[model samples]
Target: MKKFVALWLAATCSLALFSQGKPTTKPMYLSYGPTDGKNIIKFNLLGAAIRNYAFYGERMLSRKVSLILGCNFMPRGGVPYLENFTDDETLKTLEVGTFSFTPELRFYLASGYGGGFYIGPYYRFERFSLYQLSTTFDADEEEHTIDLDGSLKTHSGGIVLGCQWLVGSRKNIVLDWSILGIHGGISSGNFNGLTQETISPQDQEEIKEDIEDALDIPIIKSEVTVNDHSAHVKIKGPWAFIRGSFSIGYRF
Candidate 1:
């Protein structure tokens, strides 16, 4: 009877071991992928050949999801016509600078392969300083000089979406494409110095009187008084961009 009891116990233990599955272990960090222990970096060169010509620089942080910081420089030049006057034109030039910060979320399409996409929103703070020169050529020659030593400040927020295709997984040779939609509020302070010199005093008085009568405003008979103005400029809307580039980096 004792021998039979020992044999039954041994059979039960063998059945339990066979029915239970083998123990599972977690994957080691290094076995995951090349990016398991490192960061990524990128740079860009951009140019606009439109109303406003501009240049941009961008830096991206290293991580599963990264942060991007960038800056833009614009040198603007244009010839504008005055609606109040017929056949009158004004030529002007200005320089503007903008800085931006954004957080991005990366989606890995396939694990162990070095390719993914990202999307995010950004806040941009912009500063504008104008160094403008204007000239008007009419039957009677008139010259105006303007200097804007004061700086303009504004805020803009936007959304950006893009994708990246990496080549040679270990080397970090990535090609990226993206689109940006931006909008914001703007305000400007004028430190503008404007001076008007007519060909003759008679022409000066004639022009001054016409301006006053047309506008029905008080006339300052003096030759000139410094004019400074300040106002809020609205720059809210949707703007988009498409970019593609190749960058070399590393992932530890």
Candidate 2:
């Protein structure tokens, strides 16, 4: 895609410029996204298509170790529910916006300042807030509604294995890939406003059993959140990904 090409070129060029300015044994570089990954405090126009904007900075702590700090944001958009609600009232319900912070420590196995194969541990925290909704749903083909409000928080940590490439004369065009990565975390929801009809244990079991058929949205089966009073829920699960990145930036 044109976006990817631009991202790689921009990241590479930006990092190259940074690298040229300073002469130090310790390598310092800046890069950004699968989209626009700017070194300085800048916004990504391309990543905005997916409602994502990412910013990052990196410096080598030692000859073989580097630290990267990154933040990604969705300014005006929110994550969607697992399933689409059919009714007008349900459709009108609004969720909250989200942002994430990632801190990573990389141990380079290959020898280079700009490009190398590296592996490391990364920790990411994602927060979603300002969510409050009142919507109706069908239970046992009977219609009912509940009001709820809550914020969701996720804490995750994992390992990533990847390599970075340099393209420019000074190797500033950056292309990086984390061929494999896995993260596990607990997702918690906190809420207080729950108004609904009394539900029996059997009813809860039934709802859990055929959750897909009962509700308009689908959450992970393994990570189910439920309650008798107003239906408060929290889910714990694992997160995994194949991460690839491209950035054009200066290296110093």
Q: What is the TM-score of each candidate against the true structure?
A: 0.48, 0.56
List per-prediction Cα lDDT, in the order shown.
Answer: 0.42, 0.60
Runs off by more than 4 Å, candidate 1: 1-37, 48-64, 74-89, 92-114, 133-142, 169-171, 185-191, 194-252
Give the best candidate by lDDT: 2
Candidate 2 residues 1-252, lDDT tens each? Answer: 999999999999999999998686643333333332223222334445556677767766666787888787776443444245454445355566768888988888887554689898999898766455554546666866665566667888988887866556544455665567677776665543454566557665554454324333344323334467555544334444334344444444
Clashes of each: 2, 22
RMSD of 2: 15.1
lDDT of 1 by residue, 61-171 (tens): 333345444444455434223233444333234334333333333433333233456655666666655454232222345444333334455555656556666556344
Candidate 2 has its poorest 10 consecutive residues by lDDT at: 35-44
